[model samples]
Target chain A: MTTTIPATTTAAAVPVGAGLSMFDPVFIGIDEFGQPVYLDVVYHNLLAAGEPGGGKSGLVNNICGHGVLCDNTRLVLFDAKLVELGPWRDLADAFVGPDIDYGIDTLRRLLVVATNRYTWLLANRRRKLGPDDGMTVILTVIDELAMYSTVLGSKAQQEEFSTLLRGLVSLGRACGMPVVAATQRPSWDIIPASLRDLFGYRAAFRCTSLNSSNIILGQGWAEQGYTASDIAPTNQGAAYLLAEGGMPRRIKAAYLTDTDIYNIADYAAWTRTPTRTTGLPDMGLAA
Target chain B: MSKSSPRRRFGGKSTGTVTVIEARVHRSSARNAKVAFVLTAIIVGGLAAVVATSYLHPIVALLLGGLIGVTTGAFVWLLVRVWPVIRLLWWWSTEILLAVVLLTGWVQLANHTSTLVTLVVVAVLVGVPAGIPKLRRLVIAWSWCLIVRHRLRVCFAQFIIASQSGSLPLILWATPTPVGERVWVYLRPGLSAKDLEGRLDKIAVTCHASTVLIERASEGNAAYVRFDIKRREVLNARVNSPLVDVIDPSAPASASPLTVPTALDLPDVEVPTVTLPTQAKPAGKKSAPTTTANGSKPAASSADADDDVSDWI
Candidate 1:
């Protein structure tokens, strides 16, 4: 579907509006056979795990880029590194950076929003949120998930963060609040099977070993010859994507440079300003 | 199940009873065998006596029973023999139904109109499919589906290890895909999707496609597999995100504290070059320069390093 840009009502104002919907399929990258791949993030949670500098961050950024452009969408970003998801922080509803307390607070608020949405859904006799529901899609993207779950917090606080994040991941999907998390450490301590299984879509970037790849995709995937370990070190964005298909598929994630990220973030901020006019139709002459 | 004789039973001897007439004719094993021996015998024996009882004369009844039994055996054998052909017709029922409709439509038109109109209708039928790309693609794809079945059978005969009885995997229905084709296969004993995985490259070559992917079709059954033959590579090239286009050309981006990069990259900075230990210097050749990875000044690739003129510090 085409993104509708609302026209500027005043002569002094530049045309600024975002009408992209999150319910639409978000294009991620291309599969091995050149088929463009998309994610239905509204209904699915995505887990991206790989070795350091393996481009899992690139996949996370692509989702953030899309979320910022969508009109009826709210971004909740958690970047312990800050740089990976830093560009779109200005546009985010809540930006959590190296702060466990803030991250936990944001997640709790998200869970509350998710609960209210479910109540509304039940009252409307609907199973899940729809594009027509006019609800904002609160997309929470966490770069370096291990930081919140392992680093920067005490044991109790870390566990709390994990628990709150899990609750949001579980109840948020059907209520227009989906989570996209990425981590370099594909370990049980960082991401247990209980939490990993909650994500319907898993992208395994270049891993150091078969076991690491298995943790990201599943058991037996490496043995079946669909392993991220086989990806070369030089191939930055290469990954094995698992979606609705029972088996994982080889893919290369789309990339955006820092310049591109900043460019998008700036535009999104301007469009999302409280004073930005909306509900106006374009009446200019045909281009 | 098979071509076994009941006379050679669990311990030999039929036990000499009218239980011979009670031997079941295996209707379920029609596809498993070319002939149903016990079934034919049961039909011959059971129906003959029933037909003979209608006659009153003793000698005449005996002759009638012999004739009826022979007739029953012949009919049963004929059905058992032609079972394979019947299965083929059933498999192509869609095409057969289409042909029937077209033929019926032509006849009705001929009854109502002249010969010229019928010829024009036929011409329209031929032209319409040729004119529409979707229809032509569908017809071609379905045609390939038929071709792929034979190709896959040939591949199995050449490479796929058969069961102890020399039975090959049963090739099932195939459908068309955008990149290539997807075919389903039911493997016999001693065959699994794992056995086919290693031989995918060879299968792709045999199918005249670029590549092939084999996956388990059913979770409960390991023998049922699906082959996805790919004729193109979609991810060979790098994909640039659409966010790049969102930038306004006339207006510059306003960066806040969070909008700035972690490490500010100074654009247009000349990269610092260093002398490497592994530099190969010829007697009269110039030395090449090695550069650190700068913001946009990309680190020279290995080949670029080899070709550049180096400056010894």
Candidate 2:
């Protein structure tokens, strides 16, 4: 489902808003009053900041589980911490962890592939192809984007990631693709100004510092003093949503189980052809 | 745990059962490959013969015949020296593309065909090889088995899970309604066992499954139980028991502790625990099972196994 960006309301529909496919089990919402609530929404990008035990990682899982239900979306996870997203390797399109010497290299490779695809699409004006174009929606999920940006090491790679992310955000919508980069630390260093602007949907679970809240939800959200600990009580999956043309709205993220992720993975994998199905008369080997 | 039990008499049998099914599938796939190989050969050979008679002069025919003989001889030698992949590919090329090669080879062999008798001879030459019984039966069997086996394994895996879990009553497996390349199992979670069973029945009213497995883990609990139900050979088992082990908390130092006093993080309920007997004792002095008098028992041991046997008709 498309993300709704209302023009000028005091509250924006939560980042994970209603009418989204039921990807997660638990969701956080808000009542007419500013109290927290629980409900589910679209498996979009999420950013969670809060004191420890504020359920930052839990929010990450909730978003992932929701995205797992969207068969059209492919999940390529970059989990810097390894522990948070390791158990989910089997269910993702690809995952990067601490063991890999060149995790940044892997990310670069993915970016190259994405760029090449986008280039091809643009050259061919692929938008005209409609359903026949046979494109799969890709979700480049970075669990701790700030940490990864540091691990990337090379200045060129960091800049490249930043540019690639912005390009993906700007161009991904029409292609039914999006980037989901999350970080528990809501500091400006982790959520850079450029990258923050690209994320149309923002969620701050609960912040240890008001600066992080400002970084994620803008000044108004920071004023609310939303805490991660307030998650369940405020609303089970409740988090603030900031988007283009809309005021912040609190919505809950949904909970999903392993089976849900598996089902979607299986479906997504099957929907794509072998990449080299109909043999050509020339018998060109597939790349 | 010691792997010795009197009922281990059935241990060897279980392995054999698994092997038998595995072997059957293996044999079926091989048979299919063999048949396809033969049919492809006959078709290719027949076309080659037709081309040779119609297009090759005496000199060309002799050269072509010599070439074929050399290739055959080389293949026979390669079979003993190389792996199956090389052998199979060579065989497939010889079988399916032989005709095309022969047609192309006419230019190399010498091209001359003017008489009706010559054309008729070519037709007969090709026709006889095409009708060869050895090749035709092999091809048919291989093709049929190849298709059937691929679909069979997929169906079997699903069946095994459904029958084993006894959750078939709550779940249904159906072919894609629109006939896409993908198959899906629609899951309706949060239903009562009966409601789930009703949903399963409604879905299954139009479909059938052979095996089912159900695994459930509570939200706050670390332990999970699984039930396996089988439909084909009659094996249905469930691990209705819970086993728990010590779970060391791993929270980041920067984050709040799990047992935080603030934020009202109290869980309404705690997972029940079971303690295992620590050491063996004298046959007469079976250690008195210690029971916690006031508090929940110490953390349950992490891993446990439940095994069941069934003889389903």
Candidate 3:
């Protein structure tokens, strides 16, 4: 069943800003009232899920594109369906895709980096990584995560991926690493409850059923007037975003065309050279 | 005029006047009795002083007797004034002394044992109980409840003093909540909730709280104030943060595979010489510089040692 409310008149547009502090707010989209919504990536791991053609990829691209342009942000892209993330391939510090093994290797590499970063932070008497410390923000974007999991050869491989991903999702926020995973189907097998619980922020587009919406946004969310199933299928970029423990609000992600992606990639390339000279590799983006 | 006629003339006056004269006579008789008692006391005291100094030289005895008399009199007067407080202190000191003795004996026993053995024993005794999650939570919750109660009491006392009111706001309860702790206080009939609202920040400061919220009670004319108590940030519990002792080479590896170092452990990779920003130092270290700067030799040596250790690390 679909339910639609009349959109409010105040549509404040949120523009993407340059710079890589997780504390800096990025424009996610406009709310029901048309006022632009913003969310800071610090201390939050995000999960976005919807049916095919629900504009999930567009939202991910908008967020990732903005993040890639920031001077301090490093992007790690794991695209099981390589076509969606192909435009920004040149911009990402590390792009693994089209094959499941590469994605697994990327996850393993991220786990190692996270572990070492944690150790380095502790040795320096830092509790968590922040933008003020001149540290780089590692933003990992995993698209078609369900497909990536299915491509694993064995259950052990799947479990290993789950364990490492869980560690990154659960523990990565404070170390300036945040994982944003998106999938078309948020089924029990695709995104297990253990994995879903770790994501503090959730965005749901038009989903196949209420159950899918609940799985993505949490239980009782649908009852709480945040029913993603109510969103019309044709509303491409419209979604319900729950962030920073606030109430879920309907928002449309800022659209990023191919040209926009190219421009963001150019900015990332320009910023990469100087950032790498600081002895910290801009490991998340590719040249 | 005849005597009987004079008496009749006096009786003609009001009965109140006759009663006033009788009261004055009764008061004078009481004063006379007090004076008589004081005189007897002085004589008895003089006799005691004489007995005390009887064996000394005659002149010395007189001088010593006078001294003794004055000392005894002053002590008796002071005892009479503050006997209640002395009694209370006497009872408490005895109990406290007993407790201290027992505690000291236990500490001595523990000290006599090897440090390792003592630590192991302590860990077994306290750690076992603390290891149980339910028990640990219960202990934490109970302690939190006590702490909140004490904080609320302190805030209430300060409020009363600042308000300068004869009546006090009745505190129903101070209970913990998910965000912080909440206290229910009933405002007296003459008092306004606004009086407490204005002082919420001062109360929070006194209580060492992060923030305070004052809201009207759901049912009554009381105010329910919530205190967001400040707590020390535990770095190790933070996500993606390393454990407190994780960098120590002697620490054992965690059994969890998630924490086991995988590919990043390169032997030749040098740990960066990252100097932590010293915007804020621990409270203990703030005094170290001043002490060293004063040119105390020991403090200077210790400061040098600290610098050496940091350099080595």
Candidate 4:
């Protein structure tokens, strides 16, 4: 039986203004049993990796869709290919394309914002952010993670970007800023165990081999019968998702067609327009 | 000299020496001190009575002082006796309230109503909450949490190490989760989270759980362990995006200015345009075998059989 849940939160508790809250769980897709699967996006940073044409984009887009439709939510998107996350460009705070320096600059700025938030949190004696704080949730998504980490302009710049990204992933989670990065190449140089472990939630799409699957998910998962390589190539959206402190479970990422994307983006753009007054601040990079 | 010593004898010739036993009344310093304190209080009271002799009769003054001294000692004893019980009550106030409510409620129901009626009422009380899906899940999950607490205690007793007191890890608190229950426990001195990790299967079996994942609950304390007991999986199903219903259809189309088409309505086309070439046949080539208007290929003409392209198609 297909159960249709209307919204993430109950009718009474849904955020008052135009959309949902980042504190609310975002519906990404269904798990293996056809049950609805939602991620606590604010608390969890997701790392999705698989072969080209796999469903990494599908999962990333789901996060982006939910992010754009949220109230008091800021999105910073990096799409090296430019088309995967391009639909929501008009609504994002900063949408970087094909430029390593620009991507590094965005990461550096995001780290600054994260540090500032930590300072605020320290002053208030809070370990993490809460819904009542009224602070914006910054959702930074990198569609092609390998592009900036390995294939970008210069080795020094790429290393700087990786280092800054690692800093953000570590610092942003508690500050209500989470990173959802996707890459086609799941290699050690791109995502070492140190970097991979920083992500609390990881989705391993169909990999060409078990080792690549282990790179996305932690080590020894492939041996434990949770290998993404076992997934058929035809099953594009199927993946083994490992949330922190749990075994990897198979799930199919929810797909948003181009028209759906365009509709959502247009609506988001209308909602975030400056002329319309709302609780959110003027849209830009965080202070 | 041996006879005078009267200490030892040959083993087979004489019986074993019997020692004289004596009783000694050794005074306990605490008892003596208590007695001294009481006596001092009495002496002070007696002095106060002597001081009061100028105002009251000696007999009345003496009685009053004795009464005052006894009352002070009695009050101190009563406090010493009741403090432990009061502390215990304060520690388990909630548990005591629950037990009291259940016992009194059952008694009242049984006294006022028939046995069958009482049973029915009790059933309804439990049924109403259990009938609600969310409440039912919470109740079950928390019930599992309680079960897991005892199961862990059992596991620690049987499978894991215990502290010097032979006491199990203290279950600090528990909460219900979507999949199961999360239990936080404070490990005793002899036990560590690593020790429990090795016996997860045993603990899972005792808790009637499919799986039990143990992790350090607090970064500051290694003894604090969190157990996530999974009896079922929450992520087995394909969840449809809430965005699928984000746009309401019942509302006027004007609210959503851009209409999203749900299904494609393809126009019907003539099959001849697709199957046969649109361009006119070459003038010099043999006339192609004709197809019927229904798009069914007709039998090839005997003369044009070799050049029929439709046969290959």
Candidate 5:
């Protein structure tokens, strides 16, 4: 039987308020009622997981497009699957993909930025990063995270990646650098428990199985009627989002076609300004 | 032996080892004498001043001299004993001054604005953004950081007092982590992380946190105690485990695999034939023959015959 859940206001229906800063509520997607569902990513990193063809990329694109459009936000794209993110190459502050070693290097570079930002924040005695701060908000997008992890040839390389990503995940929020990673598989083998636990905001589209759905969300979530497994294959962009302290809300991500992506990329590229990049010399190898 | 004896005889001069020792002793005695002389001179000078001031009463002069001498001596001893502590306090004077100024300002502001207005202002400032969960967490985390920065020493003092440990734990620093805030505290001599763990709940309660975790600090006699300032519910939500089984049995089973039976059983009984209805044909149309030229009833009822037969056929 199809479970009947109480309908929620969707993202599109929610009236956009005046004087809302970029650091304020971030628009995620539309809820069941077609009202816009806005979430604050200021202090919470996001994780999006779903089966292949389940609109994970669409949801990520929606969020990333919003982020890129924000005045003081910068995008870092790590596209392990090269096809999905190739169109937005010009928009991103740093784009890494198509090669495992290059992806690792990009991550290392971002790690350095995270560390430096942390030190700067600590020195300035500021906890939250806002438009008031001279630096821009950094939003790192890692597409096909499972593939990225798998490409790490050695255990040590994986561990290093995990540690750096952990630092960014754990401490990046305070520095205004939040990571939003999408994965086809939400298994512990793909996304380690340590890294998985750091994601405070989780969204799951149509998952392959109940196990995958639960892994993306949390234990007893499926039981609580927040089952992503029940999402029909035809409803590709539909997902269940669990904010930091909020209940699961079923929302349908606004679909962005190839043309829409090109437009966003064009806009972002036109408006983009060069920001400071980490000057640390490359580590030469994946290790 | 004979050569050594001859050399000894030739060298009439003494070794002078005893004279050198005597000279060292004399030098030490002279230094002591100089210190004693300086002390005596100061005392004599003070006494002389007292005597000069108390020309009218001899008894009063003696009493004043004794009191002054004792007071001076005690003051010097105390200063020598706690010079390091005094230096540290002096170095921290700016922080203390800032704290006092802030407290004074707050008190004045509270008096002027009244409690209600102050609360309203604070609520508007902190509570508005706190409506967002992430912002709420950020605020809580930042407040924790403030606590660690300013009031951690006071909290540690209270913990020490409550524990009746008779000594203070040397606090290095308290830093906020992803899970919670980590406090580096040097356990006093003869203490361990276990000792702190025993009183951690009390500390956590005082700090308005859910719990405390004590681990050995990376380097030194310090222990890292993480104060989980976030509500227990929030922490649980952040790091929850995945559901193992489906809760709603009546819900649609989308995750179930599609299955197909490999074999089927058929009955042995023969069936009776039914008459087919004839359709109207146009005057000029002719009907096609159903039987094949070489067929023995077209191998009727065979699996291949059924495969070839369409609904139209």
Candidate 6:
């Protein structure tokens, strides 16, 4: 059942190259019942569903690592879980996380900035600038979007973040920003309806509840009669990519060690900027 | 056998490519307006300070206005008459910060005509050009060396392009095909950790993958591939249900062979062409008892004879 696919861009009616799409590689796979699936052709963002210690990080790492392999795609990781994506910093252009509050706040702000950048780019005409005008694909890979949503405290914060995430997912295709939201606890409360459709490419690892699987991959995938683990020899990083027509591709998870990420940091030494630890340092430092 | 070896396996996920529009015009226009406003404000403030300071200290007033006027004139010259140079210089200039600093210094020097004013004015002059884009980049590099705690690197997205420009090697060792859909797995070497880092580096440089993948392969060369498909738009075709079956790494090889299962339903999914990033150098290493974080034994490897259909997971 292993099928090798060639890369070709058929449709060009609307411009697709101005944004991060130009910088990143798009992944195509198959669903369980032999059908085709695309990663970011028309923007079917990632949906990761698994339980605690259910290989969530391992799976996200594999996908993010593979997804960003395309030279053009840029990974901006928000690892609120601290250790999950922290190791893969080398593979990412910019990484922020472990600071739950700051991370969530930054995600919100980044969405705004990225959206502005995208809209600004779209308004530009070839009469003014060269061909390089396009949105830089910003993959905001959040380790625990569910927890972040819950920690927002008030309903408004949750709704706002949810709405912002939805905006990101809805307008992401045109703007070149895609949200790869991963969570061990998959639930309807965590993932809003706006983003539900956006997560067309759903990947379910080992889940604790059928409800979680149902919320993620529609139905029958997490039922009692059949076990996906039974059919194949699943490893830690491996999971099924669920899409409408995607043919189920049982691919091995990619492994990235800390040393490998360190190598990337070494190369990126030239571009690293000093992080402002003490912002403005109060009026005392200013004086 | 790796679950990928079955006759019905396809690609992994979708390509999240966005249609980006050129925003250079909007950006430049806004930048021009902002720069003009800032410059005007700085000039006006500087002139006012000079006029106001004349009552207190004429020497300080003259120097302050001259300095602010010169900087404004220079910025305007570069931004208007020679925009290309300014555009290029933006990569290395102090830019917005310098202007703001100069305006602030002008105000401070006006209010305080003491030695502090002279020092502040001097600092402004030096900080402007010195804090330019080039200096900014240099400072960034320096800080990275000194202050940056963790590693920072370029992600994989900067390299891969989804265009049909040239026929690069597309190496897909374990791609699954649907019943009627034709699929091709593009292969290049060096996609595994056991592969040579040098070869992987070379291919990554050549292919420009955003992030390279290193999967524990049973047997294969080290080359990364971009999983893409060329779809022939099929209407009303019932899409297949998502795979809910979990993979059991501990399962015996006899349980699942490298052949297509009879009970599985096949959907007519569009097949796309695939491309690989670059090849990696296969490092010499005996099959060590590799344990996953889950403490599971590593999957067995496939011989070169069975490389095509044998799942390398």
Number of the top candidate by DockQ?
A: 1
Residue-level lDDT of model 4, residues B1-313, one tens digit each, is: 1321244455344353342211111123234446655765687678777877778899998887777666665555455444434543653565678789999999999999999999999999999888999888777776676666667666776668676434457776777766677889888898886666667777878888876777778879998988877677554333345675674322211111112222233343333323221112233454664666588786554324334333334
Candidates in descending TM-score order? 1, 4, 3, 5, 6, 2
Q: For residues B186-206, what per-residue lDDT tens digits would candidate 5 score against the true structure?
A: 556655655555665566676
Span of ten consecutive residues with least summed lDDT in model 1 chain B: B18-27
TM values, all candidates: 0.61, 0.35, 0.44, 0.48, 0.43, 0.37
lDDT at residue A121 of model 4 (Cα atoms): 94
lDDT digits (tens) for residues B99-198 of candidate 3:
7986885698698998888778778766976999877766665556556655665665545443322334555555654334566666655555566556
Best-matching candidate per lDDT? 1
Instruction: Give each model's clash number.
Output: 7, 54, 10, 12, 14, 117
Q: What ranking emerges by lDDT with the best candidate at the front?
A: 1, 4, 3, 5, 6, 2
What are the runs in model 6 whose C-alpha is more than 4 Å off? A1-38, A63-74, A88-100, A121-134, A152-156, A208-210, A220-234, A247-249, A268-287, B1-313
Which has the higher DockQ value, candidate number 5 or candidate number 6? 5
Candidate-wise lDDT, in order: 0.73, 0.43, 0.61, 0.71, 0.60, 0.45
Instruction: Give the higher-TM-score candidate: 2 or 4.
Output: 4
Highest TM-score scorer:
1
- Chain B of candidate 5 vs. true chain B, TM: 0.35
Q: lDDT tens string, model 6, B1-313? A: 1232334346544344321311343355456656775676577657856686957587777667666766675566455544534543442244456678878977777777877768777887669757797766555444332211111111121233222221223332223222111212333332223332223343333333221223323235334323222112111122221111112222211110112223233343221211111111122322343664589764545222122112212
- What digit string (tens of lDDT, one per residue) describes model 4 on residues A1-287? 12232311112222223468889888777775566678898998999999987789889988898887788998888887768987777567777877666777788899999999999999999999999999999999999888777664555676677888889999999899999999886577775556767999989998989788888887866654467886778777888888744878678888887767776665555555542232322222211
Candidate 4: what lDDT? 0.71
Better of 3 and 6 by TM-score: 3
> Judged by lDDT relative to the true structure, which candidate is superior, 2 or 3?
3
Q: Compared with the true structure, what per-residue lDDT tens digits does model 6 show for residues A63-147?
A: 4544333324566676655467654454455565433334446557667866676557667631221214533456677788875
Candidate 6 chain A, run of 10 with poorest lDDT: A278-287
- Enumerate residue pairs that collide in model 1: A33-B234, A34-B234, B287-B309, B287-B310, B288-B309, B288-B310, B289-B310
